[model samples]
Target: MATSFNEQFDQHGAWRREFSLRLKLLAEWLKDHDLLDAAVAERLRRLEIQVRSDKLMVAFVAEFSRGKSEMINAIFFAGYGRRIMPATAGRTTMCPTEMGYDPEVPACLRLLPIETRLQPQALMEWRMVPEKWTRVDLDVNNPQQLAQAFERVSETRKVTQEEAHALGFWHPETPEDNPVSDAQGMVEVPRWRHALINIAHPLLKQGLVILDTPGLNAIGAEPELTVSLIPQAQAVVFILGADTGVTKSDLSIWREHLLPESDQEDIRLVVLNKIDTLWDALSTPEQIQSQIDRQKASTADILEISPSRVIAISAQKGLVAKVTKDAALLEQSCLRQLEDALGHGMLDQRQKILGSAMARGVSHLRCETERVIQMRKRDLTEQAIELKGLHGKNVSVIRHMRSRIAQEQSEFDQGGSKIHAVRSVHLKLLREVFALLGSKALKAEMAELTQALGQKGLKLGIKRSYSDTFDKLRSHWTRVQGLIGEIQSMLTAMFRQLNAEYGFALQVPDQPDMGACLAEMEEVQRSHLQYLSLGNTFKLAQPEFAERLVRALSTRLRGIHESALGDVELWSKSAAAQLDVQLRERRQSFVRRMDAIDRIQQAAGGLDERVQAIDQQIAHLDQLEEKLASLAERLVSAGDTVAAAQEPLSA
Candidate 1:
């Protein structure tokens, strides 16, 4: 045999319990890591425990005189014989209150007063002596205790203005304050704030918490109820009189507050109450049916529900019929529909629990992964510190070398004769080199080479910016010549002064011989100039000599020449290796994480599809339940009418 809906529901309930336990463990991990805020962590902890415990909280809300308390008493107690909840012509509940199962506890009425004249123990004793105080508490283990508690809390005697002011129920008196003579001017005191009363009842023990909220106006007037109680509620049922249909106030409740996009969905349930009035309205049967159809259609368009789902109920009649087994009374009443709707709603809650559990599991996993990644990043940063230190040391060594070379060059120039001679030779060679390097013949040869190279190198000229390169080289050479000229001029002046003082002619040497000191320097300049003019440096020994000379000259003056080249090669290799390894590792990690995520998503998807299927089944079952309840009411009503006719004959 296939599993029944209730059986499936029970299984899902059990799964949710297990899931909640796991989520709690995950939340503990998050708290340990300081990954969540304290308040958010606390909320998650509470939600986890709430899911595991599987408690159902039903709030009864409505405008004043809409039979909210009477309905709760009738359905919950099966009759008003004992009057478990106080219901009167005016507002019976002066503040928000709660009732639930706790039979092992003593009966008590806990009051949280804004200001109090009586002590806690004194208020507890006041149930037996209601005329002595404004409120009281009583132990509810017996009928006598229950009666006493109710009487104590319900006593409505007016207090003197002075008494009211003393209790903080009225504004403080002032010199300009005028006392009004009318009863309307008197300040009304709210009886409770955060009261917790224990009731010793059999039905209350079945995981039920009935929140009896004050009327809309009263709730609006109270800041605590609006800010705290309503938000704290896991589920809320808004009751409206069906006899009057949707009123401005009813629409206001939904539009202004309840129907907004809440973080949680499906928390609010709207109840069209007091539907028995429909039966008394005078009209032909056709006219009445047409009106009901029209009203239902209108409601469907407005509330986005099928007319059949909008239950029209008479709370008073349904409670009597449930106990009496009179189908006729039930048929004439709408209470049966309301009961069916509530039952369906309870089943729907089970789905919400399962969804929340799965969501928490996914969230926990993501948070855990993020925490681990952050820790890894910190470790990598510590490892990178060594690289920075090495770079700084290299920069200092290069700078020291450059300073030493500059000091040596200055010392060599102090004699004036060597400086004059070296500068004159350098200037002469520079002029000759420029004449050789910058010529029409060389330019024409370079242009032809460029054109030939362009054809060979993918149809572009040498794959380089020749004009910019030539301009930059010429600018550098010009600056070097100017420096050499300045040195020469200074040396000439110093040498002339020395010659005048000593009366001897000093002869400046010509350019240094290529075969003598710095043989590499002569080879380099000659080879480089040849390359520029002829477009090639094919001689092996000369080219090698050119590279050696350039390195030797620059090394003493700028240590960066050697270190820069070495650093460039080292960084390029290191970067390539590091990037390759990281890329491969990242690819593998990405694949692994993606696979894990895919599996989770697939599992969640399967669960979602199953849940949707179950939801459809549940909806079908609800419709059947509604139809069965309607049929039962009709049958009972017909039987009652037949019995009445037979009674007349028997009499």
Candidate 2:
């Protein structure tokens, strides 16, 4: 037996819930590790927000009277035993409508004023101000209240040609196709710019958001709908009448609006709706089947999608069948297959999106952190090797250090004068380095650098922004180079003095190359400039430029600065530590020599215990290295699980 629509929806909900939980867990892990930096964190946070807030948006698009609303009714609202959304024939759903559940807001139908279309802000921005919309309370269980409130989508207002133009309805080239004018030359337009119905339904509250959009005129009038909302949806169902598949208006809506959306066909499902219209009273079953097949194939060809994607379904009949508990009629309506397709195809893709986010947040961060741990482990291993080598040659080295200390002590006891001289040199070098390239100097300059990038004319001025930001970064980089040279010179001189005075071998490491650092900044700058230049005409794109550009610069500069500081600090500390160790050896050398002769007598008896202790430490480090390696494997395995779950989404 085929699955019921309710069962499919429930399964979809279950899968989504599990996917959401996994994403939340991944987010928590990333947050704990402090790896969710601003750049990578946004996508992870969006997934977490969508899961927690239940905002998986699915859109239905079609020309007027294509049974798009009916499909929604049958698949989702049929459980109510009647249509919950308006699906009446002949120009129903005049405005674009959205159905979702907002837990914070009361269940209601809110309509934005059509006059607001003249404003420059996006529709999402307008939603923030509740006073801009007309609200009507809704009780979900009450059919009459829902029916009454839903009628607002079909509400119309008479407007003159000038008023129509201002609302984005009348273009000079398409004057003839404008809404049929009355005797007074007044055209009718939708009274509401947009309608949002917040329903208190389990599926809606379980992360199912639906967009029910109208035909060509409504879509063309709204730029935000085409640019932002539709593209962001998990799936788009494009409905067409089976009897008249892919009409001119339908094609227009598909090409002009839906086609431009990202992952157009990948996330799109074309529905040949109103298949009941093709049923003939006298024709044989085979003839009807052949006719429907021909329509599906032709529609697929017209839409440039596979035939398997063009589904035929009688949504009106499907609603009646499900409500009346008629199995045969329900099967005949073909709604079950469509439901499965949506449940498997669309819901699966949604799950993949969540899974991908989890992999990014968890696995990517785990790998980066593990890499740092591995580096530290390597450094520790080197230190351990040095200790082992020193232990093996302890007798001979201590004898030589013993005689040198006796000679030094005769000259001066405690070596206080030598220690003070070394410390003085280290302090002077540190002060000079901090003065030039300290965090204070770098941070103070960043504000002015960012402001210079943001200062522009009425246009985005992408070229000027890039030029100024890059120049500032270059100057900062040059200063860092100069500081590195100064530090390098100080270290070379200081190390030479320590070698001559204390007879220790310590050398300065090569200065970090600024070329790679500069290249990274240039690359980020180019990407930001490219993004801003592409959509410079849109005011919405302006804020993104400022936010992304600053973030890019800050992240790259912070990385470079940290690298420079690490290099300089590591070299300086290593030199000071080596000097101090030599000085301590000089002071303790004679005592250790006397003690070494006694220790040799004692070790002659207890040598085995000491060797055993050394062996245990070696074994412990080996175990630790193995454990870290195993952890890296686990991280990879966890990432594979998410990828495996995503595999079926493409099918």
Candidate 3:
């Protein structure tokens, strides 16, 4: 199981390097030819970072004692010949644990204090601050020491009900949902808010992120998990215990968290774990198989997913099979099926996402360069034609052509002033768009809403805050959309005027799609409303939780603001880049024409030589184009080969 995913990932990474190499080749060529602009260079650098730092986020979500940790151990840490995560018995993972490799960070486990949950700041913000976490250096050579270090994730502390309630764990209204209190009236809660483990594991190095989420209590307390983390993961694995089947809590977790949006694909895998528990010695093997099949079908019907998405696997047996090298038990465990599904789904889906993003950026950069080079080629052909037409003509013909070229240069210089005026207006308008959508703008809006909402009742405050905030945000969206339209309209007019007057074929760039960003804002609002509907009732009533929820949701909305700003900036710049490339190419063409005529006038019959010189430049551009085509082909084909082998995959 490890080998298959590892092989696919290694192949993916190798070819990804090839993609980077091709980009480097094109970038160096552009730099050498002085065709690279700020936009193109920035895009090239972004693609480089993306290719080098791509990670597939595969989240394992399940209720407690669903063998999630065991499944992870079987699939990822089986090579260790022992359990890497604390999967000994009931609910070993007390908090959310993420495992991955980072060369920049040393091999260690970092735990954020559970006490930090009292703060309004989110886990994401805390993650950026090193001093806030308790870091434990891992001794990889010693597996026992490593396992002991992992135990910290499951560590718990006794806290009073008041403290737990303040930490957003205990609920007075839902006493059944609260943790059991001891004789001293103290509840057991996770000592840490989150765990981040950095290991030198090969799969982690291959860019596989393993997210191990705890049961309902821990997950419900973390708003970031639902609002950001889980949805963003490339693949999700929802495990269920064969012993308990889909218990009420399990159903709650599934319906509330794992359930997909209507438009979203139902890609999450439902693993019927602990299947070995169903093995009946008195019954025949066929009877046992019948029982397992029935369980799987029943689970599928209940979850409203196809039966094919549910895989019956014994994580404990699989782990043992792997450690003991028992092929028969390993096959019976059926971990391979789940592994293949997860491996292909995560790696391939992530590959497509990475490919599409890079393709957009790379294509934009390449096309811009191609446009400049193509224009040069066309100008070269014209220069050759102009020179060749002077076969038997006198010096007066050459002088007339030179004067016309000079006039054309002056016309272009005058057009430059118009281009500058448009660029100036575009930038001024872009600043207006940014002002409404920037982080500071979002913060200011949130602060005012927070202050105003505080005066209302808890329920009213929650509803009104979300309604008012999103309403104002949508207004900002409308304004940004209008400004973006104005910018695009202005640029479109500029492109058309330039083409009509200068005989250029400049296409107007499409308007920036602020729709996707706006939809993200809508998603956050929907989830917040859903959270309210799903009965975070008591949690919302509390001032701390109310404030935390606001801050968490606000953070996401603020991110969208900043993202919109950058995106609008990039789109506006892209349009300007196209114009700049064409204008420079046009100016160079006039220079080449004037130079060709100057050479002819200086010599007694050098028209043929001058035409030959122009022909050489045309041939050079042909080679340049061939090289670009070859590089582009290599970049696309690098993933195409690997992608063809990837069939339907899941997690």
Candidate 4:
């Protein structure tokens, strides 16, 4: 039996909750030990939020009537005993629908007006302004009513050809390629540009977001669907009709929407859906099997992925099997296999990505704390060793020891001048970095690109201008990365000087990689480049829509820029905090040593007792160090349920 998506999602939720608890424990430990200052506390809060809100998004992209919606209904909503999403024979789910649960909001259906596309703001920006959406309350207890309410997503409006053309739904030059006007000069357009469904479904509640995308025409109409949403999904299940094989439209959707590399490591699955269409009574079981194999192999060859990556399944049959509780049909449908693939593939991939990121931050925090603890341990040991020698010493000898200690203190304090200089340079370098990555620079670049694109004409010309916007941001990142390198280099030299002078033993901070951010910027460019090819070139070729598209694309680029800034900002703060922590530790160590000497000077009654106390303190820190190490190890490795680098595309 395949592992239930519900069961797997629950497992992920359980794992996530446990991880959160551990993070909380780590935070508390840092607080209790006085390792968490305001900055550290803020970072901890962000980490917790990241863990809580992390979702495994799966995009089901395909041509019309490829069983994309049916696959979703079968894999997730079968327990409703009927299809929640209307998955009939024709083009249903006209708009791109996102299915997820947000308990903070009421259970409802929120639909963005199709007219919102006329505005310069993107769908992503529109999400923040809830008032723009048409809200319908969902009654989970009344499934029939809820299903009917959802049917609005597939509803279409008869728009005049001029209106449809303006919305990029009608193309007069390429009428055969997209939706065309009827004899009455009216074109059918999706009533809503996008749909947001919030439900109390178990899988959705556990942060599994299901993206049910419409066909290429709808995808082309809404550039954000292809540009931002689909590319960001943890996995994309490219559904194809098994009977139809790779149709022209299907191939177009694949190559166009998906920026597939030649390597099969991309987080995607090829599901040859509607295999039931191939089940002919005249054909033997062996013959049917042979037909399925050939199709899968042929799809793999054409798509240039490994053959094992292509999964053949009857989604229609799967839904029937699930709704009717027919085990044999369900097994034959291979819905369970797809479920297993998604569970093992997407969920686990999300875990690793999220876990690794969390681990980097938490580990850095732990290491800083551990360094302070080690310093405390070393101080105690030195104190104990000095006290042992002091047991039999006379007043003159004690005076000499105090003199040496005072001289050391004087030298350490004298380095304060050096500290001020290094700190001044550090602040200046940080200022330069922040200025380079400032929101002002980002806005200026976007505005410049938008103006340039708005002046352009033709699909190819406009696409180049759109791509130039991303390249501009990439250049910004490259510049920021160089500035960060300079910052890191300066900090390393300053820290090494301090380590030699005051014994901070600071490890030089690594410059955060802009590669990931740059790559994502490149991806947005590629997806939007395809967005131009959807035969909606005439629409985009318009100066107003062209400018609007660039402005909308700005939302995505802004996010990328902010993320890169945050990473660098965090590193800078961590680096400075490490120095402050060491300085504080050193000052405290001096105070304690002076107090011990004063006590011994006052009266030499219990020298052995003081020595023993210092030893015990050192021993306690040794135990604490072990615990801290264990905690960091567990935080990183906990819920590493996924194995390393499995052939993800394989069945």
Q: Who wins the TM-score comparison?
A: 3
Tens digits of lDDT, candidate 2, 1-651: 557645765665665555555555555554564333342344445545654564667799888888888888898888788787888878889888999898899999999989887664557667789889999999888987797789889998999987887777766655655787899989899999899999878788776788998887776666556645675577888888997778888887777545643432237778998888889999988999999999999998998888998889999999999899999999999999888887767666655555454555444344433433333334334333433443545667746644654675676454467657756766775666655556665555555554555555535455665576568657766765776677677767866876676554545545556665566566455544544453323322334334333543454456566756655564455445444444544445435334443454445534344445445745654654454445434433433454433332210
Residue runs of model 4 more than 4 Å from their true location after superposition: 37-47, 178-183, 262-266, 301-306, 394-414, 456-471, 533-536, 642-651
Per-residue lDDT, model 3, residue 117, is 87
Give stretches of model 1 more than 4 Å off: 1-50, 79-82, 101-105, 114-148, 151-189, 193-195, 200-206, 246-257, 261-264, 281-309, 354-651
Q: Which 10-residue span in candidate 4 carries the lowest summed lDDT? A: 642-651
- Enumerate residue pairs that collide in model 2: none
TM-score order of candidates, top first? 3, 4, 2, 1
Task: Select the stronger candidate by TM-score from 3 and 4.
Answer: 3
Error of 1 at 555 (Å): 74
Please tell me which model should have the higher TM-score, number 2 or number 4: 4
* Best of the two (2, 3) by lDDT: 3
Q: Candidate 3 clashing pairs?
A: 341-650
Candidate 2: which stretches are off by over 4 Å?
1-55, 260-265, 368-651
What tens-digit string does per-residue lDDT give for candidate 1 at 1-651? 222223343444544454455456555644554444433354455556655555556677777667777677666655324556677777677666667655554556665553433232222233344344333456554555565465333333345665554442333423122223256556455554334456644434434566776665444433223323454355666776766666765664554334443434335666666666665557775776566666666765676666765655677776667567777886656565555455455545545544544454344334333433333333233223322222324445535534543563454346446535755564564454444334332344334433433342322232233333344434544454454345445545644754454222332212112122123323223333323232122211132222322222222212222222222223222222222333333344334333333433344434243334434644554553343334323322322232321221100
Pick by lDDT: 1 or 3, better one:
3
Candidate 3 ranges with C-alpha deviation above 4 Å:
1-3, 32-35, 358-363, 389-404, 448-464, 637-639, 643-651
lDDT tens readout by residue for model 4, 33-136 = 77676557767787888888787788999998898888888889888888888888788989999999999999999999899877878788889999999999
